[model samples]
Target: MNAQAPHATGRQALFANLLFWGMLLVGGGALAACMLVPAWLDYQAARQAAWAAHARNDALARRITAQQLQIAHHQRDPQYNERFIRQEFRIPTPGVQVVTVEADPTGIVAPADDAERAHRPAEPVFPAKALATARRSPLLAVFVLDQTRPAVMALAGALLTGALCLISGPRRS
Candidate 1:
């Protein structure tokens, strides 16, 4: 029995060391995954939002510049000025005829004139540069781990720690 006692003590010491190291690795890994992964995902989302806003700003700037050019052109044209005044004030110019078209009660306008449609600008396409920029964002291999809830991650860590400790058997001292 006395000889067996020393063997039991030795086994306990070995298990205690194993438990300490296992807890260290498992606990550290879990802590890092729980905190860092979510923060990284959030940062990625914010960056994408900012890039979209920048692209929208560029599109609006181009539209505004186009509008300014149209205004300048209008200001230089006597015909446009006369038309504007007549349209706004409903005043008739001498020797000029104005035809009024009444809208249907259902409120849908008749098809626009082909000439009017031809002069309208096309809708802008999404910028290729923005798409390329988004595509170039770095993808993390650990992102798969992010899908698990933080609480679940914590629970898994606890379970693993408990399992390892159990495998190491009871503490001696």
Candidate 2:
């Protein structure tokens, strides 16, 4: 008599289960990876912003400290006056020659005009923006969600749907 092996159905069920489990594993892993991409991108942006803010704050603090020191110098130093300031800046100082030269293309030094340079207020320097971050790529922006709150939810839903279908699928004899 021609008949199928007694364990044929059992073998088929085992293979089917292995395949379903394998797909679940792979799909879940992929989803987790996808979810981490957004988080990683946000982390990099935050790090850059933090560094910029720290640098700006440090620059401003140093400027304030320098100004305070200057004030203290004027209050404490006995010789701190208009003459002293001018001498410090080498302005109108007798017996001292001031020379400014420009480098010529022919390697010759060309002295600037004989006129004394007038002291003007220094140019204002504004600190760089603290909130500036790297620009996002247009293609990447489409995939990066604002928030990845439910990282595992999608994997879970996919697993459940696949499992239900696999279990309830019609069986052939």
Candidate 3:
């Protein structure tokens, strides 16, 4: 009976130790998660923003490259300016006269009511240069944040979580 009593006490102590370690691990994990999740989310947001900015910059660069190529082509071609002018203005060549014939008012009548115009969809205008100029680079913004309070907060949270975890570890008998 005396030997059995010691065995039961030993089992109970072992159980208590396991439970204590389990609780400590769970608590430490929870604390670390709480500290890390927001920072991780913020980092992801910043990364996504940077990627989006990079995509936009890439698109702009492609567009500028295309435009530059077109300009270079036009500069190289002697007849390009004349062709452009003729296409744009519908100007006749030398000794050629232009004639305009208007349709009879009775035969072709314009819409009398303003409702038709109001219901029509407006033309979609893309002012690419304006948009590009207006937007700040996401990489630059991220760099700024890295140098600011948010980065410090994240670092401090990580350090604190690590310290807590170490403190909560199983003790040596």
**Candidate lDDT (C-alpha), each:** 0.65, 0.60, 0.59
Candidates in descending TM-score order? 1, 2, 3
Worst 10 contiguous positions by lDDT, candidate 3: 125-134
lDDT of 3 by residue, 110-148 (tens): 666644543454432222322232235443333233244
Q: Which stretches of candidate 1 lie over 4 Å from their true place?
A: 1-15, 92-150, 156-173
What C-alpha root-mean-square deviation, in Å, does candidate 3 show against the real structure?
A: 13.8
C-alpha lDDT (0 to 100) for residue 12 of candidate 2: 84
- Give, for candidate 1, the lowest lDDT window spanning 10 residues: 138-147
How close to the true structure is residue 78 of candidate 2, measured as C-alpha lDDT?
75
Task: Give lDDT tens digits, candidate 2, residues 1-173.
Answer: 12566477778889889977876776666565556656666667667667766766676678779999999989887767866888788678677777888667698755553122222322222212211221244434333433433544566568757866787889876
User: What is the Cα-based TM-score of model 3?
Assistant: 0.44
* Residue 43 in model 1: lDDT: 66
Query: Candidate 2, 144: how far from true, in Å?
Result: 9.2
lDDT, residue 53, candidate 1: 62
Query: Which wins on lDDT, candidate 2 or candidate 3?
Result: 2
Clashes of each: 0, 0, 0
